[model samples]
Target chain A: MIYQTVIGLEVHLQLSTKTKAFCGCIIDFGRAPNTCVCPICLGFPGTLPVYNKEALNSAIKVALAFNCQIQEHTKFDRKNYFYPDLPKNYQISQYDLPLSRNGYLYIYRDNKPKRIGITRIHLEEDAGKLIHEDGQSLVDFNRAGIPLIEIVSEPDLFSPQEAFDYLTNLKSIIEYLDVSDCDMEKGSLRCDANISLRKAGSLELGVKTELKNMNSFKGVKDALSFEVGRQAELLDRGGDMVQETRLWDAEKGVTVSMRTKEGAKDYRYFPDPDLTRFHINQDMIERLRLKLPELPQEKLQRFMKEYSLSEYDAKILVSSKEDARFSEECIRIYPGKDKKLMVNWLIGPLLSEANSRKVKISELNITNDELISLIGFVERGEISGLSAKGVLSQMIDSGKSARELIIESNLLQVSDTEELSKIIESVILENTKSVDDFRSGKTNALMFLVGQVMKKSSGKANPKIVGQLLSRRLTDA
Target chain B: MAIDNETIRHVAHLARIDLQAKELERLHVQLHEILGFIDKISNLNIEDVLPASHILPISNVLREDIPHTSLTPERALENAPSKKGNFFSVPKIIE
Candidate 1:
């Protein structure tokens, strides 16, 4: 029997607020243990949380961007648990009412767009880190109290690749909106996946397993792929699936069972009394909607239609906002009026150099104007393409102009017809056997003679003109 | 309403609480009363009403990509109960 895997992702994004969610403590990462903590975040006996306005605004922006229905009146709930990392026995989160709901993100697969529904996006506080030493564990409160927005998606994803694409699109949108860094390595963005397998046509969901501790997008893919196979094997062997939470060991490439799944009643959720409810009017929504910059999808379309770039090229350029901006600047400078040469150079040699140096194109010493000048020089036949590469290298290293490098190296194009004609005539005379072959049916001999003329001129002669003159002289002879 | 002994033990184990048998018996009646009172919510007409998660209509909060200086090794270890050089010290688990 065929089995279909159902997967849902819960992504926790740390908001880029200036302070902690409900406290005035500075929201910073990589700080000393307990250095960023305060009474409010540490959950002191007398400390009361005062919600940060910026955190609320940031959460609203995410809700609106995902097209979720906003809740008019919402409140925070306390989730009770006894974890050492959580200094406060109970975590303040949303229970019955979340900030947004019923949103969708479109994923492109096999040349078709599939809409994945978003269940909810809720706001919460982050917990601290625990570093286990030889005999004991050490707690760091630096990350505690940081505002986090948890976006939960419906179990609409069937394959690992679709989940990967959905995550990529989500990260691109969030980063483009300048909400969170969405850096998985830095823990600014984290994801937990719930997966289950059911009969291909079954309407009921199978016993689900929750996967945690994936550090990267690749980790998520690998973990999900492993779980899918594991579940399918269990069902094939007539083993009953158990509902449990599993931790992904990335190094070992397997999922280990942590504990059995807990029901909703386990948390004992209740409304937090310290905070007050706030409102979001249509005017405020319009203001934020207007402030949104051109998103990746719009930029991709513009790159294809206006710049006449291939789908593959446009996708690569628009994947990162920095790369897209760099490409746009290059096009603005060079204009690509001649054979899309600028685009080729930007994608090829420039990308290679940037990669080799471990830097972005924006960080390169060569300015957009300089690159344009180099392209213009090649287009006008002022310098050969080979010589232009040398000029570009010099421009990157020494910040020199193409014209200056061309003049210094005496590498001007030998476009003078008289000079090139002399070289072409001499090559034709020198290679008589080839010339005779050209007069006959061997067209390749004519190209050999043109190559000889270019070699004699030290690769400075324009190949187009050399070919034309060589064929003209060969036919006349 | 009186709570049963079996129900009290199940709820205690689900909550990871180590409760004595006598204590469970006594708490059963108290829990039953509390749940009986809370059940009044089911009487309200909320079939079509949506549940609320947050009060404010907030979205799209972002931060700029900038790297600030990290905590020094000394400061990072300041809160550790045991320390070895720059790292926190722990018992040896594997031989």
Candidate 2:
């Protein structure tokens, strides 16, 4: 029997505000243990916590970008728990009424737009870090009270691939909004998944399990894939799933049950007395809406229509904000409107160069002017496209201009008729067999003669011009 | 729903507090009375009244985005029950 999988994600994105959510401590990562702490974040007595306006504004910007409905009146609540990392023994979070709700994130699957409903986007403070040493644990409160936005998506994703696509799309929008870096490695953006399996076309949902410890998008997809198979096998054996929280042991590649059904905790949530309700007005929402940049979807559509590119090419260009910016900048400076060429370079060679260098495409040292100039050399017949690739490698290494590299390395294409004729004469004199074969009605021999000429010219001769001159000379001979 | 002994025990466990059987019995009774008062409010016929998250009419209580000097390591760890080289030491958690 076939089964269908359902997946939902909750991503916690640390806002890039200058200071902590409540206190005025500067937000710095990888600081010396807990030196950024203050009385307010340390949860000392007689210290009243105040909300940060920048955090709220950032949260509203993200909510509007996702098309969420902002709640006019929302308040913070205390999520009570007993963790060594939490000095206050409770987290300041939104329980019943969150800041926003009822939104959607659109992801393209199989060339069609799929909408995944966003349940809510709530603001909360981050917890501290716990480092375990030999026989003891260290608590660092520097990260405590940092502003975080929890984006919860509805259970609309039906496959692990769709879930991955949804996450990629979500991260793209977050990056474009300039709210957070969304770096998974630095722990700025973290994700947890809820997945279950049921019979195809079943009305009621199946027993779901919460998965944790997935650090990257690939890890999330792999964990979901593993869970889907596990649940399907249990159902085949006439067994049922138990409700619990499972930890994704990424190294071992399996989900281990961290707690069983009885492990569910009653948070006993109540309104935080310290923070007052937030009354979001229509004017505030409109102002934030205007601040929302052209998100990934809008930019993707515009790139396709304006550049006259295929959806596949446009999607690749707009997937990352940096790549999209590079493409647009190169096009703006290029003398000709060859968007396809720019798309090919940005998505093809430039991406490969970045990967080989183990850096982001935006971190590539080649400037837009250098790239445009390199492409211009090819368009102007100064260098063959093949020769330009060599020049590009040197340009990337030395951070020199394309023209500088071409002239320094003598990589100019041999398009001059008088100069190329000498190289062609020598190639014909040596390759007598191929010349005879070409006269005997073998067209493939003519290409061999052209290759010989290019080799003699040290690959500087333009192959197109070489082919034309070789055909004429062979016919005359 | 009425507050029960099982709920009280679970809540105490979540709060990380150890409670005796006699104490649990006393707390269950006290919670029932408190919840009873709250239940009475729930039974009132105020359908048109907007649910208020806070009693005060104040909203948008916020602070500006500015950085201030933080406490030094000495004062930051002053009240810690256990300390080791500028960090608060706690019992080792395996997970």
Candidate 3:
């Protein structure tokens, strides 16, 4: 139908503090369900919810990391709804004045950064979990009263891939800030995407459906793709669309209408009487802003400039905080001048090992010392490049040192000039034409002779040593 | 300052209060009188005055992020009408 898709995302991040937001109850997930409840969190009468200070710090850090404007005067509101998930009949969330607003996060689209606008970030208390059993539902109050921050984005994305990239970059920023657990499988990080389609050139927006329950980033992307097609077909048939909430069924790969959205008035949002308004001071904002580390974009640029890595390699390294930390450590501690050697090992052999093991590079448990020493084996020509690859594979599997594995497997390179010269002399007799070419100043022929020696030595001859010896033999004779 | 039956019924529904027809009729008049008394202030022009929900002029009350011992599960579920395995059982409200 040639309609441009308008997408905005709202991400709910659980603050990684030790306790619940309003109370001092331990927020230990999966600790026998209701064990974490207390009078404040359970909504017992005469109880007041106290704001968690650490949560404020984390939220301010995240907002600052994304370049948000921290509001000086903000307040919480009561969103009234009758649901079992919320132990209290109403949830304490923000209404008009939130903690921060007007932030922008940069996402790479078409090899250039597209600045996605962040509408606002507000702190709220999470609800409990309701498990629907045979007929009735069971509620666990453990998760209730946990601190959560709602990050609302502007409708800046146009496609499903753009939404996915936005989410990926957002998660990376969250990890760099180290605020939340940032795990989707565990529900620590959750996202709700609102997407609408309008005529290609029309300025007005179409009725957008709010999508929820996407378990992963890929699930969100897939659900959006499905929604795009579904909406386009309905529009093509000139059918009317309604604003509603839909749940993404990952198993069925379709979005089912959950409920027609009730207008905001239905919630009857009012200023929360129990919790008073917060006057966010400039000092707190400046402190949190100072606490923000080098975010993904700046770190990506620095990785390229400082380490001489390509834009592609730098992005891969800085995609996750773990990857960036590991690569940065290895680069910092690397004995050689060329940091690409360390980066190549990180993005190449170690990356393949991580993929096979189904983990991130940081989780592979190979310390930077171990990785650098393994790379050093290749740099010193103690192990041939081909055999070094084998040693690296076993190093991760067996958790052994590169020297130990090389010695045990007898895979050391023939770097000894005396031993390599014999193979070099035999190769010279075999390739007399290339030898004459080298004598005639065809220096490229030297590389061919090194390859011949390496082939004779069963790929064990270090090419560097063979070249040195071959040059000495041809010229000194 | 007028109160209608539909407005009274919606408000009652939102508050989860069961109101009889006779009570509804009585409240329709009673609520009108209540609003009429409060609406008398509308005649006074107070544009410069800032609206305040709470009389106190304080904000930013917060607590440290340290955890304390939580209540035992038995005490937590003690007031529940129905319980199942440390959970409060209720009618299903799934969408």
Maximum-DockQ candidate: 2
- By TM-score rank, best first, the candidates go 2, 3, 1
On residues A1-477, what C-alpha lDDT tens digit does candidate 3 reach at each position? 699999999999999999999999988886997999899999999998889989989998998988899998888889988788887899989988899999998888658879999999998999999899887899999999999999999999999999999999999999999988899999999999999999999999999999999989999999999999999999999999988889999999999998654644478888887777788888878777887889888999899999889999999899999889988988999888877878888899889889998999998867899888887888777887778778888888889987798889877788888888778888889999999999999999999888899889878877887888889999998
Question: What's the lDDT for candidate 1?
Answer: 0.81
| Model 1 chain B worst lDDT window (10 residues) | B59-68
For model 3 chain A, give the 10-residue run with minimal summed lDDT. A258-267
- lDDT of each residue in A199-313, candidate 1, tens digit only: 9999999999999999999999999999999999999999999888899999999999986446544777878766655566777777877877788888999988888888777
Error of 2 at A313 (Å): 1.4
In model 3, chain B matches the true chain B with a TM-score of 0.85
* Cα displacement (Å) at residue A395, model 1: 5.1
Top of the candidates by TM-score: 2
Tens-place lDDT digits, model 2, residues B1-95: 49989889877777677999899989998999999999998789999999777788787889999999999989999889998898999989874
When candidate 3 is compared with the true two-chain complex, its DockQ is: 0.74
Among residues 3 or more apart in sequence or in different chains, the pairs in candidate 2 whose N, CA or C atoms overlap within 3 Å are none
lDDT of 2 by residue, A1-477 (tens): 798899989999999999999999989996898899999999888898999999999999999999899998889999987788887888999998999999998888678888999999999999999999998999999999999999999999999999999999999999999989898988999999999998998977899999999999999999999999999999899997998889898899999998643655777799998889888999999998998999888998898898888988888778888878987887677777667877788777787888898876777889898898898898888898777877877888899999889999899888998898888898889989999999999999988999889888888898889999989988997
